[model samples]
Target: MKANVVVIQALEAQIAELDARLLQQAKLRPEYLLLKTMPGVGEVLATIIMLETGDIDRFAEVGNFASYARCVKSAHYSNGKKKGEGNAKNGNAYLIWAFIEAANFARRFSDDAKRFFEKKKAKTNSVVATKALAHKLARASYHILKEKQPFDAKRCFA
Candidate 1:
């Protein structure tokens, strides 16, 4: 127990140093600011999104962005019969983690987000509910990055 605590403290100290350095060297871009306006995103999430998605114009549509971020389900259906699954590992893993983290933060911090999540959870399980919220957030982020605009909860929630 004592050794574990010592290791944990060492890791935390290293993480704090890294965070300080990133803050010093990181250039806050316009898109970074725009994405940060999102409900759950802060410095870390916004930075990861901006860095991973180098060019917002590269994605032609929100669906494409969501797919690339692994926000959407990858099931195959033919003639209204469910086929099989596609390669689920085909997209950016970091974005998936970031969006899920953002969704969790949103659920805790925003009332509207909590309601949306609850509505989804009523129909599905917890994992699906969280993913649905993550998907919604991913779509909103797509628009935010593309338009360089702040997040609009009215348009998003409605």
Candidate 2:
């Protein structure tokens, strides 16, 4: 068991190293560093964001990027009744995963994030709360990339 654990740890380290190399190759190390300034976005999430988004110009708008981050509602309703579940299939899986992971991390590390999450949760469920945070992060990322500026917590949360 101990040997297996050591092997697993070694493999995880190797994967992280490779991920770093890939981030460098993509010329996104700077962007990744900028993202790391966020309360919950670390190197891993930053890398995932950069890898998943690639060229910001491809996303015509922040809404498109938010959708790609898996932040859009998956269902639609009309006249106070549920219409069929909307297709939530289109998106970047990596970005979705990264945002979810960051949301989880933020819940643990940032009181502000946790409070926002809880407020959202009181109205909806846990999944919705996480997605809401992901949406905010996606929009923040878009502006940051668009203006070539750093993330501002006040503007981001607002």
Model number with the top lDDT: 1
Model 2 TM: 0.81
lDDT of 2 by residue, 1-158 (tens): 99999999999999989977876676565667777877788776787787778888988999888887778876778998879776788777888888778888887888778888999999999988988887777788888777678878778765
* Model 1, span 4-79: residue lDDT tens: 9999999999998988888678776788988988889988899988888788899999999999999987899999
> Local error of candidate 2 at 19, Å?
3.6
Lowest lDDT 10-residue stretch of candidate 2: 23-32
Question: Which residue runs of candidate 2 sit more than 4 Å off their true CA positions?
Answer: none
lDDT values of the candidates?
0.91, 0.80
Candidate 1: where is the Cα deviation over 4 Å? 1-11
Worst 10 residues of 1 by lDDT: 20-29
